[model samples]
Target: MVKLDNVDRGILHELQLDARNRTAQEIADKVDVSASTVRNRIAELEGDGVIEGYHPKIDYEKADLPLQIMFVCTAPPTERSEMVDQILDIRGVVDVRETLTGRRNLYVEAVGTSTTDTVRISDSMHAMGLSIESSEILRQRQVQPFNHFFFTDPYADGDDNGED
Candidate 1:
């Protein structure tokens, strides 16, 4: 684990808000540091493996795969590795998470053109001998960058309606 000072955390907060658009100078402006300092810190962070990589924030609905299905399963310990690899290789599989605490050890998400494809993916997992406890998804609600809200609230530029 990294032990970051207040300034380091502040720089990270700014970067988290918008890594693509924010330049080092802009981030330095927000965090009260020189641009060179921000640049150096970021380089160090990347070297230390703290800042791994950047990714485009994708909207699944806008993409062709509007239907999302998550399968929560419990597979034998022996089969976990192979099951994960197979899941990753499967078409339409977007993400797979292994959990420490739950009736299900793995949560696998797959995007489908329709509900039938989602079921087919789950059934294939069953064929691999995984015990699927549940398969469900609703396209109604989602929150983006929700996990980092607390870390970067100081730099957020969004309008708040708390007064109203």
Candidate 2:
């Protein structure tokens, strides 16, 4: 496993907040490091697979495709990984998550312009032999960076970092 120091955690925290607009220099300033160091660290993180690709948060409704459906499905444990890969090739599918256990082990999210589009996506999943247990319309989703990534200096605030 990759061990992350405070500076590394700080870099990740700042990037998670806003990677699109935050430059290496800005992150370096937050982490109290040089700009070149931040750049090199980011590169190393990417190379080590610690930092995955940056994805933009899209507003599908604003784009005129308002329907976002979440499909809870089941697949054989052995086939789960392959099914996820194939499901990603389906049009309108935005996300897929695999759970560790239970009957509904696969969760797939798809966007569409209307019911017809969503139905088509459902049919495709069935063709792949996925037994869909439930499907729901997604209302909203909120995401934030992990709080532990934000290093709070105990001495800076004279609070012992919330220790008991």
Candidate 3:
């Protein structure tokens, strides 16, 4: 694993908040280092794949993609690859997950310019031999990183339900 010092961690934290705002000079000022040092550290982080490429967080409403759909699907064992390929071909699909649930084994998150686009994607999935268990338009009230839930323990040992 790549080891990060406190400075590196702080750099990452600040970048995560607003990747586009701070320059190497500003980051260096915040971290009390030379600008060249900050640039080199960022380069090192990128080279090590710690810092992936940056992206602009686009507002879907302003972008004309107001509809967001989550598709829950099940693929036949023989058609799994075909189903996945079809889903990847869809224009607006942002993310897809192979879920543990046997019935709705795949989950897809897609954004579209209209409800027609969402329905078209869903229909295409069904035509590709994937069973569409259910689909719903997602009205995102708030978005949180999945790592927040997965990395932290939300309950104590005493709160166990004794499933194991």
Candidate 4:
């Protein structure tokens, strides 16, 4: 694990705000660092695994897959990895989150054109010997940005002085 300093946090903040099409030089200007420095820091972050790959935020409404279904699956501990791989192969399944402290060990999310397809994905998982529960996602409300201030606040000290 690598520790990130204030500058590193600032760089990450700028990238998250516009990483889809921002250049390192652009991020550098915002973070008050040289362009090469920004680029190198980003490289270091990626190398250290702090920064994962970047991806686009798709508008599922216009992408033909409007129905979102979330699922919870409980399966044999030994078969967990295989179960996730099989679930990923299902047509409507989009993403999966593995868990550590819950009754269910797997959380799966899928998007489809209709509820029937989503249900079919769940049924298929059942046939694979995994117990599954699923729900329809009516809407995706929000994805809030990271609190860059929490990491970059200069006045912050070991003790809380005034601001809350």
Which candidate ranks first by TM-score, i.e. highest? 2
Write down the lDDT of every candidate, Cα atoms only: 0.76, 0.87, 0.73, 0.76
- Per residue, candidate 1 scores C-alpha lDDT tens digits across 1-164 of 87776567767766766788989988888767899999999998888888888877677788877888888899877667667888887788878887765458899988888878887887788888888998888565453442342444544556331110
The C-alpha RMSD of each candidate to the native structure, in angstroms, is: 4.2, 4.0, 8.5, 4.9
- What TM-score number comes out for model 2? 0.90
**The 10-residue segment with the lowest total lDDT in model 4:** 155-164
Those runs of model 1 whose alpha carbons end farther than 4 Å from true positions after fitting are 78-82, 144-164
Question: What's each prediction's clash count?
Answer: 0, 0, 0, 0
- Provide the global lDDT of candidate 1 against the true structure: 0.76
TM-score of 3: 0.71
Better of 3 and 4 by lDDT: 4
The candidate that wins on lDDT is 2
Model 1 weakest 10-residue run by lDDT: 155-164
Number of the candidate with higher TM-score, 2 or 4: 2
Task: Show the colliding residue pairs in model 1.
Answer: none
Tens-digit per-residue lDDT, 1-164, candidate 3: 79887567657755765668878777776566888988888999999999988887767767888988889889875656556766888889877878655677888888898878977888888777778888888887364332221133332343322111
The digit string of per-residue lDDT tens for model 2 on 1-164 reads 79988778878877887899989988887778999999999998898899989999999899998999999999999899888989999999999999987589999999999999989999999999999999999998788777575455522545432212
